[model samples]
Target: MTFQEITKDEFAQFSRQYSQSFLQTRQMAEMLEKRGYQPYFVGIKQNDELKLAAFMTSLKVFGGLKFELNFGPIGQANEAELASFYKGLKAFVADHQGLELRTYPDSNYRTYDPKGEAIDQPNERAVEQLKSYGFDFVVRHIGFDEQDVVAEWQYIKDLAEISDEETLLKSYNSNAKRNVKKAIKNAVSVRVADFDELDKVEKLIEGTGEKRKFATKDLSYYQELHQAFGDKAEMLLTEVEGKAIAAGVFIEVGSEFLYLYGGSDGAYGKLGGPFLLQHTAMLHALERGLKSYNFYGISGKFDGSDGVLRFKQNFGGYITQKLGEFAYYPSKTKFKLIDILKKITGRK
Candidate 1:
C-alpha cells in the first residue's frame, strides 16, 4: 500500500459519491493554507488501488518547529485498514522529522473508556472504530437540541418572498425582535466594519474569551480569513452611544452561516447589547437567505442544562451533534506523556 495526494477534482468527486461522516471541503483547505497553515492530502492505496483517504493540515506556532495538525477528516477506514493507515502516517511524520501529529478526527471525540465498554453512548459505529484505534477520551464541549424552533436557511431567495423585517420578526421569535428593537431604541447601532477596524474586533474577541474561558486566535487569523473568503466573512460591530459594546466575527459557507466568535462589554450587560448583537447577526443571515446559522459549540455536558441550551435556542435553530476530533498517536511514550500533561493541566 502507498499514500498519494488526491487532486481537488478527485476529492470533490469522491465526496459526492460517498456517504462519509464528515465533509471537509477542499475550499476549507485552501482557506486554512491562506491563513498560514501547511495543508496536505493523503490517499492510502492497496493493490495499486485507493483504499482510504485523509486530509491533514498543520499550523506553525512559536516558530516553525512547534507544529500540530489541528483536524483531519479521515475517509472511511476499517479496523485493519485503519491500523495500516496509521502506520503509514506515522512513517510519513517520521520522515518529515515531525515532533508529533495531533489529529482531531471529525467523526469521533471521547468515545471510549480505559476498559472500553463504551463509556459514552457510542453514537455511531465510527465512534467505536476510533476507540479500536486507541484514542484518548476528551470532552471539549457538550451540545444542545431545541426542536420546536427548528428552521432551515437558504442562501438565495426572492427578496419579495421574505423581506428582512418579515424574516427577522418571524425567524428570531417575537421576543427576539423586541430585544433588537429595544437595542435600537436604547441607542445601539449595528453595522459592518472595514478590515482596518480589526483592532476593535480583536479586543472584543479577547474580552469574550476571557469571560467565557475559551481559546481565541489573534487578529491576524480573522484578517487572513476575511481576505481569503471575501464577502463570505463578515466582521460586525454594535455600538451604544458611539462606544463599541458588542461585535461578531462570522463566516458563511454555502447555505450555512457560522457564528465563529462574539463578545460584548461586560460593563454594558444591562442594555441587553449582546443579545441584540446576536439577533442582528441572525437577522442579517436570514436576510441574505442562509439555510442555517450554526451557533457553534453548545455545552453538551448538560443534557438538561437549560441555561446554555436556552442561550442557543433563542436563535430558532435545532441543535444536532456534529462530530469532533480523532487522532492516532505514533509514539506510545509521547502519547502517554502528552495525556499526562493534559490531565495535570485539567484538559480533557
Candidate 2:
C-alpha cells in the first residue's frame, strides 16, 4: 500500500462512491481555504486502488502546526487496512512536523429513541482499536461547547418514516404543533432565500448570537459557504409582514439534510418563527427525498427547562451520540506547551 496526496477531483470521485459527511466535501475544503486553513486530500492505495482516504486541514499554530480531520477518514476498509492508514497518517504528520492531529471519525456511539431511551449500544471495539493506535479520546458529554472538533450528540428526524407532511406534523409534540399553527396564523411564511438575501440571514444570526452571547462568523464567510456548496445549500427564512424574523442554513449531502446554523429575533418569539423555519426546512428535505433531517448539535444533558434541547425534542427526532474526538500528538511536550499558551492567550 502506498500513501499519497490526491487531487480534489480524485477525492470528489472517490467520495461519491463512499458514504461521507458534508464536511469532507470539496466545497467544504474550498470554504476552509478561505478561512486560512490549507486543505489536503490524502489517500492510501492498494494495488493501485483507493483503500482509505481523508480530507485533512492544516493550520499553523504558535509552536508547530495542527491537523484537523472533521468527521472523516471515510472509507470501507477492514481492520488491517485501517491500521495501515493510521501508520501512514502518523508518518505524514511527522513529515509536516505537526504538533497534534485531531480527528472525529464518523462512528455511531449510541442511538436513543424519542423518549431518550438508548436503543443501541456503542461500538466499543472500534473505540478500543483507535486507542491502540495511541489516539487519546476526549470523552465529553454532548453539546456543552464545541471545545472538541465537533459535537458528540445530534438530533435527527427520520423523514423516511413519514408518509406526508400531515403525518410528520402529527409526530411532533403538542407544543410544536401549536407553535407551527401559531406561526401560520401570524402570517409567518418561510421561503428559500437567494444568495442576495444572505445579508438578511446573517443579520438574523448576529441578532440571535448577541442575545445568546455567542460569537458568529462574518457575512463573507457565509458568502463563501454559499458559493461553494451552491444548490446543496439552502437558506430558509421565516418572515412576517415582509420582515425576516428567523433563518437557518441547511446542507443536503446524499440522503441527509443537516440544519447547520439558525437564528431568530426575540421580538417574534410569540409568532414561533423558529419552529416554522425548521418545519419548512424539514419539509424541503422530505420533498427532496432525503432520508434524515438532522437538527444538528444539542447538549447531552436533558431537562425540561433546557430550551434548546426542548425545542429540538418537540420536533420528534431520535438522538444520536457520536464517538467523540480523538487526538494524536506527535510531540507531547510541544502539544502541552501549545495548549498552555493557548489558554494563557485565550485563543481558541
Candidate 3:
C-alpha cells in the first residue's frame, strides 16, 4: 500500500464506505480551519484503491505541531492494514515537524444496555494493539468539550425498530412523552431558524451556558458549522407564542444525526421546548432514513449523577462509551515539556 495525501474529493469518495462522525468530514475541517487548524486528508491505497484514510487537523503547538484524527481514519481494513496505516501516519507526522499525533479511533471499550448493564466485554485487545503501535491510551472520563475533543460516553437512540411515529413516541419514557405532548398542547412551535437568526441561536446557547454554569462557543463557530454543512445542518429554535425558549444545533451526516449543541432558558421548562426540540431532531433523523440519533455526551459514570445523562435517558436509548483517546509522541522530550507546561499554565 502507498501512503499519501489525497484531495477532498478523494477523501469524501472513499469515506462513503464507512460511517463517520461529522468531525471527520471536509466540512468540519473547513470549520476548524477558521480557528487556525490546517486540515490534511491522509490515506493509504493499494492498486490505486483506497485502503485506509484519516482527516487530520494540524495546529502549531509548543515548537512543533500537533495533529488530531478527531473520530476517524475511516475504512474497513484488517488489523494489518491498520498497523501499516499507523506506521505511515506516524512517519507523515514526524516529517511535518509534529510534536504528537493524537487519535480517537471510534472504538468502544464498553457498551451498556438500556438498563445500564454492561453487555460487551472490555476491549482489552484493541487497547493493547494500539499500545504496541506506540500510541498510549489516555485514561480520561471528561465529557465532550474542547479539551476532551469527543465524548467518552455517548447516549444514542436507535430509530430502526420503530415502524411508525406512534411507536417511536411510545418508546420514549413517560416523562419525555408527557413533556413533548405538553409542548404541543401549549402551542409551542419548533422549526429551523433562518440563516440570519444564528445570533438568536447563539443567544439561546449562551443562556444555557449561564444557567448551567458552563462555557459556550462563540456565535461565529455555530454559524460556521451551519455554513459548512449547509442544509444537512439545522439550527432549531423552539418558541412559545412568538417567544424563543430553547435552541439546538442538529446535523445529519452518514447514518447518524446529532444534537451537537443546545441551550435553553429555564423560564419555560413547563412548556417543554427542550424536550420537543430533541424530539423534532429525532423525527428529522428518522425521516432521513438515518439509523441513529446521537444525543451526545455524558460523563462515563453510570451512577446517574449527570443531569445530562438523565435528560438523554428520557428519550429511551442505550449508553455507549468509546475507547477514548490515544496519542503517539514523536518527540518524548517535547511531549514531556508540553505536559509540564500544561501543568504550570493550569490547562487540561
Candidate 4:
C-alpha cells in the first residue's frame, strides 16, 4: 500500500462513497484552516486503488505541533489495510516532527439502544491493529476537563419510524410533550435566522456560557462556520413577543441532521423556548428527508439529573457510545511536557 496527499475534490468524492462524519468534509477542513489550523488529506492506496483516506488538522502549541483527526479516517478498511494505513500515519507524523497525533475515528464504536442494551460491538481486530501501531486509548468524560476532541456519547433520533410532527411529539417524554405545548401556547415561534442575525444567537450563547460557567468560541468562529456550511447549516431562533429567547445551530449532512450548538436565557425556561427550538429543528430535518437527528454530545454517565443529558433525553433518542480518542506520540519527551502543562493549566 502507498499513501499520498490528495486534493480536496478527490478526497470529497472518496468520502461520499461511505457513511462519513461531517468533520471529515472539505468544508470543515477549510473552516478549521481559517481558524489557524493547517488542514490536509491523505489517501491510502493498494494496487493503485484508493483504500482509505483521512482528514487531519494540525496546529502549533508551546511544546510542539499537535494534530487532531476528528471523527475521521473515513473509509472501511480490512485488517491488512488498517495496518498499512497506521504505518503510513506513523511515518507521516515522524516526517512532520509532530508532538502528538490524536484520532477520534468514527469506526471504533459499538451502538446501543436507548434502554442501555448493546446492539453492536467494536471490531476487535481493528482495535488491536490500532494498538499495535502505538496508539494509546484515552478515556474521556464530558465537560471542560475532557481530554478528547469529541464527546464519547451522543443521542441520535431515528426519524424513519415517525411519519409526522404529532407522532414525533408523542414519542417524547411526557414533560417534553407538555413543554412543547406550553411553548406554542406561550406564543413562542421558531424561525431560521438570517446570517446578519447570528449576533443574536452568539449573544444568547455567551449569556448561557456565563451562567453555566463554560467557555464559548468568539463570534468570528460562528461566522466562519455559517459561511462554510452554507445552506447545509441553519440557525434557528426561538422568540417570544419578537424577542429572541433561545437559539440552536443545526447542520444537515447526508442523511443526518446534527444539533451542533444551542443556548437560551434561563428566564425563558418556563416558557419552553428551548424545547420549541429543538422541535422545530427536528421537524425541518424530517421535511428535508433526513434519516436521523443527532442531539450531539452528552455525558457518558447517563445520569438522570444531568441537565444537558436530561434536556436531550426528553426528545427521545437512542444513545451512541463512541470508542473515544486515541493518541500517538511521535516525540515522547514533548508529549510528556505537554501533558504536564495540560494538567497544570486544567486543559486538554
Candidate 5:
C-alpha cells in the first residue's frame, strides 16, 4: 500500500465521490486554517484502488497539541484493510516524528457496532480496540438519543415534514419562547455582520476568550474565512448600550447550520445577550430555509438533567453521538510502555 499527500484542490475533487461529514469538508478545514491550523490528507492505494484514507490536522502548540489522524467521513473499513491502513499510517508519522495521532472518525462508529446494529448506547468494543493500540479514550458528554426532546428540535427538518413557522413554534419548548421574548425586551440587537466587519468580529472573539476564560485564534484567521466563504459564512454580534456584549460565528454547511464559535461578555449574560444572539441566528437560518440549527459540541458528561444540557435543550436541537479519536501507534516499546501506564491509571 502507498500513502501520499494530496493538495487542497485535489482533496476537493475527492470529496465529491467519497461522502464526508461537515467536519471533514474542505470548507470546515479552511475554517480551521483561518484559525491557523495546519491541515493535510493521506490516501492509501493499491493497484489503482483507493482502499483507505485519513486526514491529519495539526494545531501547533508551543508545547504540544493533540494531533489527530481523523478518518473523516469514512467509517469503519473492512477490519483487515483498516488494520493495514493504520500500520502504514503509524509508520509514516513515526518517520516524521509525529506526536499523539488521534483518530476521530467523522461517522459515529460508537453509536453502531461493527454489525451495523444500534446498541443501547455507545459500544465498548471499538473503544477497547483503540486502547490496545496505545490510544486514550475520552468517555465525554457528547452522546444523544434521537427520540429525546432536544433531538426533536435539533432535527426539526425530520421532526415534521412542514417548514411553516406556526408548525415550528409548536415544536419549541415554552422556555425557548420565553428566552426569545426576554432577549427582545432587553433590547439586544442581533444582526449578521458583513465580511468587512471581520475585524470587529475577531475582536469580539478575542475579548470573549479573555473575559470568559476560553481560547481564541488570531484575527487574521477569521478574516481568511470571510474571504473564502464570502456570504456563505456569517458573524452574528449582539450589543447593548453601544457595547459589544455577545458574538457568534456560524457557517451553513450542507443542510446543517453549524454553531461553530460563540462567546459573550460575562456582564451581559444576565441581560440575555447570548440567548438573543442564538435566537436571532435561528431565525436567520429559518429565513434562509435551512433544515436544522445545530448547537454544536455539548458535554458528553452531562446527563439529560444538567443545566447546560437544558440550555441547549431550549434551542430544540437533537443530540448526535459522534465517534471520538482512534489511532494505531507504532514503536512496540513506546506502545507497550504507555499501555501499562494506561492500564494501571485506568484513564482514557
Candidate 6:
C-alpha cells in the first residue's frame, strides 16, 4: 500500500462512486485552490489499484503544518487499507514537517423527522472504524460543531418518495404550502440568475448577512463557484415587482441538490420570497433527476426555539447528523505543544 498524489479528475471519479458531499467534489478543489489553499488530491493505493482518495489542503499556521481532509477519503477501505493509509499519512506529514491531520468524512450518522424527532439512530461503526486507526473525535463542542464546514446536521427531502410537483408541494407542511401559495398570489417571480447578475445577488447576500448577524463571502467567491461548477451550480433569485428580494445558492453535485447559502430581504418576509425561492430550487433539483433536495444546516435543538430550523422543517424534509469530523495527531508531543501554545496566547 502507498500514499501518492493523484490528479483532480482521478479523485473526483473515485469519490462519485460513493455518496459524496459538495465539498468533496472536483469543483470544490478547484474553487479552494483559487482561494489560495495548497490543494492536493492524495490517494491510498494497494497493488497499484485505488483504495481511498481524499482532496486535502495543506495549511502551515501557528508554527506547524496541518492537513485538512475537509470531506473525504472517498472509497471503501478495510482495516488493512486504513492501517496502511494512516502509516503512510504519518510519514507523508513527517516528511513535510506537519503536526496533525483533520478529517470530516461523510458517513452513516442518522435520520430525523422535520420536527427534529429521531427516525433512525446513529450508527457508530464508522466512528469506531476511524478510532481504531488513530482518529479521535474532536469533542470540543458539546451539541453541534459550530465551525463545521459542511452541515454536520442537515435537513433533506428525498425525491425518490415523491412522484410529481403537486405531490411534492402537498407533502410539505401547511405553513410551507400556504407561504408558497402566497408568493405566487403576490406575483413574486423566481428564476435562475445569469452570471452577469452576481453583483446584485451578492447584494441580497449582504443584506441577509447583516440582518442575520453572520459573516458572508464577497462576490468573488460566488463568481469562482459559478465558474468551477458551471451548469451544476446555480444562484436562484426571488423578485417582487421587478426588485430582487431573495436569493439562494444551490449546487447539484454528488447525489444531492444542496442549498449552500441563502440571502433575503427581511422586509419582504411577508411576501414569501424565501418560500418561492426554495420551491423553485427544489423544482430544478427534480428536473435534474437528483435523489435528494438538501435544505442544508439546521440546529439540533428540537424544542421549537430555532426559527431557521423551523423554516427548513416547513419544507417537510427529514434531518440528519452526518457523523464525521475526526483528527489524527502524527506526533502527539508536537501536537500537544502547539495546542497548548495556541490556548496560552488566547488565539484559539
Q: For all candidates, what are the clash counts? A: 13, 0, 0, 0, 15, 0
Estimated TM-score for each candidate? 0.67, 0.92, 0.94, 0.90, 0.70, 0.92
Q: List the residue pairs that clash in candidate 4.
A: none
Residue 73 lDDT, candidate 5, scale 0-100: 29
Give, for candidate 4, the lowest lDDT window spanning 10 residues: 140-149
Cα RMSD to the true fold for all candidates: 8.1, 2.3, 2.2, 2.9, 7.1, 2.3
Sort the candidates on TM-score, descending order. Answer: 3, 2, 6, 4, 5, 1
Residue lDDT tens for model 3, 274-306: 999998888888888888898876766567755
Per-residue lDDT of 1-348 in model 4, one digit per residue for the tens? 897888898898998887677788888899888889998799899887889998998888766778888887878888788778888887787788688888886754667666556788765665666688789876544553362226567778989887789999988999989999999999999999998999998999888766654456678878888999999999989999999999988888888898877899898799999998988998999899888998876656544534677688788878877666788988788788888998899875
Candidate 5 lDDT tens digits, 1-348: 666665666566666565444556677677766567778776666685666555567765332333564435243367666666666666666765554566664445443221223555665666665565555665332333311111111221222343665555565579766666787798878877776776677877777556534446666667776666667688888887677787888777656576666776776677777777876777667777777676754434343443345556665644555555455444546656665776788844
Compared with the true structure, model 1 gives a TM-score of 0.67
Whole-model Cα lDDT per candidate?
0.59, 0.83, 0.84, 0.81, 0.60, 0.80
lDDT of 6 by residue, 81-153 (tens): 8777767775777787777787776764777777777887677887887787778887422132364446677
Flag regions of model 3 displaced more than 4 Å. Answer: 143-149, 213-215, 337-348
Model 5 misplaced regions, further than 4 Å: 1-3, 16-22, 27-38, 45-52, 58-67, 71-81, 109-119, 128-162, 185-187, 199-214, 240-243, 266-273, 287-289, 303-308, 332-348
Please write out the lDDT profile of model 2 over residues 1-348, one tens digit for every residue: 888888898889898887678888999999999889999899899998998788999999778788988887878988888888888888898799888898887888889986668998878887888898889997645444453226677888888888588998998999999999999998899998988999998999888766654446678977887899989899888999999999988898878899877899898799989989988888889888888998877667665534566779889889888787888998888778878998999876
Q: Of the candidates shown, which would achieve the greatest TM-score relative to the real structure?
A: 3
Candidate 4 stretches with Cα past 4 Å from truth are: 108-126, 147-149, 213-215, 333-348
- Cα displacement (angstroms), candidate 6, residue 348, comes to 7.8
**Which prediction has more favorable TM-score, 3 or 4?**
3
How far residue 10's Cα lies from its native spot in candidate 5, in Å, is 3.1
Error of 5 at 284 (Å): 3.7
